[model samples]
Target: MRQEKKSEKQEEKNKECLADLHTTDPRDDKERIKQTKGGLLEDSSNWILKHDDFRRWRNNDEARLL
Candidate 1:
């Protein structure tokens, strides 16, 4: 029916909108570092200071092991 076709089109449009919402453009590595590592530093300066590459370190797993 015509109503069924219109509903299908609306559903496709809604899916396209949701797909665009889900994709994130790649962010600058430094900015991600600043946000996450800086937050950690702000929270606990002494803990992060022990690591030489604290600014660039991504995973806290190694730090946790230490």
Candidate 2:
């Protein structure tokens, strides 16, 4: 779908732009994504997990994603 292709292109662009970025902290990536991409599609939250679970994964790297 077009959305998938756009996401892939944006991801590739971000990778190239940030290849020189070196930091264990994920704050930079999160900030960069917030700037470059639209916040979230309407109703997209329902496509994945519940809001609380999503928040957990967003904050905790050790959390399992399914």
Candidate 3:
């Protein structure tokens, strides 16, 4: 029940995000970037590369993606 509500809320939010995609203004993007200045997310790919599963995959010769 709780999960359903969360899923519905997320679906609504996704719709809202797409609703603006077709009509985004450059000024809005500039302002959004300015608002997030100095707080933008940094790369986290290193964390994934260091995980044990990733290490195993990197070392394995027969672990094809398919």
lDDT of each: 0.73, 0.76, 0.83
- Per-residue error at 11 for model 2, in Å? 0.2
The sequence of per-residue lDDT tens digits that candidate 3 reaches over residues 1-66 is: 999999999999999989867777888887899698843466646789889999999888888665
What TM-score would every model get versus the actual structure? 0.37, 0.30, 0.34
Name the top lDDT candidate.
3
Better structure of 1 and 2 per TM-score = 1
lDDT tens digits, residues 1-66, model 2? 999999999999999879867555678777777788955457866756667767777789666454
Q: Rank the candidates by TM-score, best first.
A: 1, 3, 2
Per-model clash counts, in order, read 0, 0, 0
Model 1 C-alpha lDDT per residue in residues 1-66, reported as the tens digit of each score: 999999999999999999988855466655787787773344455767667688446455666665
**Candidate 2 backbone collisions, by pair:** none
| lDDT measured at residue 47 in model 3 versus the true structure, 0 to 100 | 86
Give the Cα error of residue 19 in candidate 3, in Å: 0.3
| Candidate 3 lDDT score relative to the true structure | 0.83
Candidate 2 lowest-lDDT run of ten: 38-47
TM-score of 1: 0.37
Q: Which of the two, 1 or 2, has more lDDT?
A: 2
Residue pairs with clashing backbones, model 3: none
**Regions more than 4 Å wrong, model 2:** 20-66
RMSD (CA, Å), each prediction? 8.9, 15.5, 12.0
